[model samples]
Target: MFKKPTTVNRMSQPEDFKNAFVVGTANVQSDGKLKWKIVAIFPNAGSLRQHGNILVVAGPGGGKGRIITVNLISWGHSAIVIDLKGETYTKTANARYKVDNGKGKVVVLDSKNGTGHRYNPLSVVSRDQWFDLAAELISVTNGDPFWSSVANDLWLAAWSAAQHARRPHMPYAVELMKLDLSDAICYFMYYHKDDPATMQHLLDFLGTRPNEEQMAKIKGGNASRLLESMWKTVKTTMTIFNDTILLNLMSGHDVDVEGMFYNGGITTIYVIVDETKPRVFAAFGRLIMKTLGDALIREGDKQNVVRRPILMLFDEFGRVRLNDVFDWLDTLRSRDIVLCIFLQKLSQFAPKNGKEFDESDENSFHHWILFAPNNPSGRIGKLISGMSGQTTVRADGGVGRSVNMDGDITTSRNVSFARRAVVEQEDYETWGADQAYVTLRQLRTEKYVVTSANTDNLGWALPPEAQPLPRLSSYVSPLMPLPSEIDAATWTAAQQIVEEAGGDDAVSNAMRAALGGLGMAVTV
Candidate 1:
């Protein structure tokens, strides 16, 4: 027996999510509304601006294009799409140009081949956020904890110096990271001479504390074998962006992240990727995740319903990673930030690093839409089968036929109503091009229906506007009064004065204090 209201929800619910992407339109008609399986989120009226994350699993010829990109035209919000090839933008740019009443700004970032707009991801980074960006750029891997720690310190020192010096570019960070320890120490101490907290951070990074200074405890040099190995690892990881095209694109700011949301017009950004250099995408994805995530969370708290939602549509998303993705998903709740991830199979989304995949990973998305599964008896098929409620079917059977009264032949039948899956395992595996399966986590509902697969809204696109590259830039603080910078005579005199004071503080600090009086730089 079929439970009408519970198993087959009213179409009013899908209408509630009018703005969400349509998974399918028609279902078993009931009560003047079409029953359907639509991957959508319905926040209460009070949280009208929020939309939950989405996961779309569609295999080949499952209409992935019509569902994700072709339908992208109607999204009517701020979107950052990961266009694997140039096709997504090529097909959708014109319609996107006409979005938001024809005022929408469409920007493209193709750092791999250096076409379209350039984005200096660090352009808007504040001094306080340097450490976080540092951590992201150099990821922690399965390695010695001590070396990983040293690499972090090294990144922190270089990033801090670059940020303070006003050259917060990847190329500049790479330049600073490659510096010898003494030069970096001098760079940090001099640039942050007025900021004691940063001075201590630099000193601590140098593996020393002046008050407890000991000669044998010092381990602050690039010459050590262990330290060299750490540098090699850092360089290898950072090699993602150390090249000419990547560096030039990330060298300066052309994109305004916060303004794109609040600018009163929708902004559609396409991040073009070269299939060969996917790790390069990690840098960009993490940058946008942090910047956009911070801005949306801050604005969402204000309950500004007028601000348009920012939807990040990632086609073939499993190929790249967002920085701290699951944590990012948690933060997006009730925030006007939405992400729709598309993959050929759910298995593609599993971690490549040998970490076990958990149910919670799948739970992160509020909606999951499946198209004609190539293997309905596979995990996805079983998942859908399990989610759907079972229904009883009436059957009539008889052991034998017997002639009863008046020479009429009749047989008494044994009737049974056996429970069966709404969508059998092999049913979807043999699905035609028009069929689709949609599930919503909140409603705990599933629908197998003939989808409209509608993409009629997609229209002509205009040529993407070419953006000229940003000008070359750099910054520096005057060299500090390190031993290398000071005259030999003055250094010897300062050392003699320090010895006479009955203490063993490095002469560098005393020189920094003296130079601090004269407004000169000094190193720790």
Candidate 2:
């Protein structure tokens, strides 16, 4: 006895909404003919600016991921891509055309064996913020108050000492575990011996180590004991430092965060990681998110103009353990930072022991695009079904039977059913590789057949070889900081030693042994 509300369309036609950006075309029937109709990816630039963040889900070789990312790049958007296989975004020289839209410059930060630009995780923030930065690098969470406090203190102490000595921002993890309390005290005293004010500051910072009396008051030995336990925990979670390439790369300030984010040019940071080295990718991924997020926050406080939009594409998001990504998603959207998280299924985002996703804001992104999934009855299917809402359904069936008493008799029965999901599980499983279902908060759902911008009119697809290389707006340098006291002569000698040893690791071990052999004799 209830009437379903009539579906109302606000736009008389697609053209009524001017300035709408086309994401792709959809098969539509207009004027009694079936034809491809241009579909707006976003209603307008304002909508995009307001709700820029997007979540892209597709399976292997789905084609939607490439189509969407390539389109965005061609639109002159700035982006940072985590190149997992090294072929998606920046494999070929011509692939640069996908991102070179005259709006910005692209810089690739290669972490695969230290052949690319260097990125120092600690260089973005001031010395005062080193404590927090160090904790993040170790993947510290606030789940346990006591352990959190212990880890924070341990990281702060080690980071403080390093900053005071002007050492590498992120030192070897082994050094953190092996810090000698007495040696740390002596190092501070000897380094700042001439300056009384500097010595006092160092003393007060190092004074947090609980003395004998304080140790007796607690069941545990003292603060130092707690620090050691926390260091063990930190060491177990992160193993990138064990690899010389990762340790060396993280120790120096390589990528310029300010130039990438606020330079008003198209800046690109390409993170290339080998499949065999997933741990390296996870570390670099976390660093990229932290560095960029912190830099933008600081710039927001300093700059007078509104923040510009920046797009970030994560190729295989679920491959890495991004524990803090939930927090980033909740905060970064407001900072004018857009993140495109690519995953294969909704189950990937689900918590290990909970029904919901790990983050409360997992569904906070205003726009969503789902390509055809392999299994619709699975987690992603159920999620998309729920998101697509429900509609009234009417199914009618008739049955006939013969009545024995009347000789010539007929019986009829009818069955009816209502209530069905607009997009069923089977629908998702049957979608084509190039097809995608796009949904926005206040707009009607659309189905897009993604293709290159002018591929349809050109009547032929342009292969990677045929694509032109993009023009560079500016030159990006890869010069990173080196030990100040290690003069040119010393560095040249070290290089010669490395060449003779036939490997970087051997040379590094030799240098460390050489420094240890000097004992207290060497002084800068």
Candidate-wise lDDT, in order: 0.50, 0.45
Per-model TM against the reference: 0.65, 0.59
Task: Point to the candidate with the largest lDDT.
Answer: 1
Stretches of candidate 1 off by over 4 Å are: 1-51, 124-129, 180-198, 208-233, 303-305, 350-358, 390-459, 463-524
Worst 10 residues of 1 by lDDT: 392-401
Model 1, span 1-524: residue lDDT tens: 11233421211222233343333333333355333322323332234234466666666655556555434555667778888886778667876777777787788877556666667665665557756766666666554344455566666655555556666456676765555534543444435554544444544444422222222233452223322344455566566666566666666666767665676467888877777766777676666666656655666666545656677778887765542666667566556677777888766654534464434355466555554333445665454443323211111001011111111111112211111112222332232102223322211231112234443433345544522423333323222333435334443443443344324444444433443334333333
Task: Give candidate 1's whole-model lDDT.
Answer: 0.50
Q: Can you write out model 2's per-residue Cα lDDT over 1-524, one digit (the tens) per residue? A: 10222222111121322333434332323354222222224333334445556666556654444444434433444567777755544432223333344334445555564555556666677667655665665644435434444445545544554555566645533354343433432333344344443343333332233335534544465442433343355455445645555555565564556654556455666677767877767667666767767776676455576445666777776676555565566466666667777777555663433455623444445444444333445554454343312221111000111111211111111211211112222332232102222322111221113332232222222244533422222222222222224434433443443344334443234333443443343323
